[model samples]
Target: MSKLKVLGICGSRRDESVNMKLLRYAGSMVAAEGHDFEIFYFDDFPLPLFDSDEEAKTGIPENVHRLKQAVREADAIILASPEYNGSITPLLKNAIDWVSRTSARLQVTDEWKGKPVGLCSCSPGAMAGLRGLYHVRDIMVECGGLVISEQVSVGKAFEAFNEDGNLVDERTSGFLKAMISKLLEVSQALKKA
Candidate 1:
């Protein structure tokens, strides 16, 4: 089988965000699995809040277009989200809104259709970022993505990684490995289907 291209989206904006660090670790795991991985920091996209009027006049913003192109090129997506007030961060939701707008042009007919997805989250709280993953999974399904049922949620994320961003905890690392494996399995199945 050919190598798969996996896109890792760090939905958190903080420079030292635990969620982003987890995503980096996930990328490393994907590489070990003999697949290619690219990480997209949402802060890099600079997409404006979704507005149909602006889109009508200006067409898709270049940043939005670039993000859409990335999504189009990838065979699968892994989302690293952070929970804020028991849900997904607004920044991540805003980015999703921008991507969803292009569904009118692409949606189920073109790119992103039946794409495999893996959900993950990191938080300092005790919930292990489960709420954020829950929110992202629902949104991914709405976008016609085939979300992998298994997820990686890390609690006390502040201490889960080393200074170099490697996952230091054995249990967390194992969970992340399983998550990547599941993502790859689903990705291949979706392509075959």
Candidate 2:
């Protein structure tokens, strides 16, 4: 199997974000499978709140372009975010908004088309941030990303993971593995096709 480049995006600002913990766990698993899995945060790119006026005046920000490049280079992407009011975080939505736009004078926004994306979420509630994942799936699908059907959600996130970023429950860990494996398999198949 060809090693895949998997980009994991954590959409939370908390210093000890459970979302990031989930990504870290996934990253290790991806590595164990002999693939490259990199984790990134919105702050890593350091883009201001997306504003159309600012965009029209200055064009796309350098960070936006850089983030786009990361997405373009990856074989698959994992998005993990906590549910806020039953939806995705504003930070994540803002990033997507910027990345999906195009400047006829600058470039195109075709990067999202045909891209493979996986979704994951964790929350303290029993819902497990699943509600937010649905929203993410909708938004990515609208952007033309091939959102994978198999996703994972961890409830009681504060207690779901250990200091090592491993899920406490074996069954939950299996679900996470299945999701990542499916993502790798689909991405490899798409690359071949």
Best by TM-score: 2
lDDT of 2 by residue, 1-193 (tens): 7879999888787888899899889888889999998876665677788887888898888888888888889999988899899998988888777778876887857567788998899998999999999998999999999989999999999899887779999998899899988989999999898
Model 2, CA-based lDDT: 0.87
Worst 10 residues of 1 by lDDT: 102-111
TM-score of 1: 0.91
Q: Would you estimate the TM-scores of all the predictions?
A: 0.91, 0.96
lDDT of 1 by residue, 1-193 (tens): 6699999887888977888888888999999889999987667667788777887777777887777778888888998988888887888887777766743553322345677888899888899879777888887788778888889898888888888888888988888889889889888776777
- lDDT values of the candidates? 0.82, 0.87
Alpha carbon deviation, residue 148, candidate 1 (Å): 0.6
Off by over 4 Å in 1: 103-110
Clashing pairs in 1: none
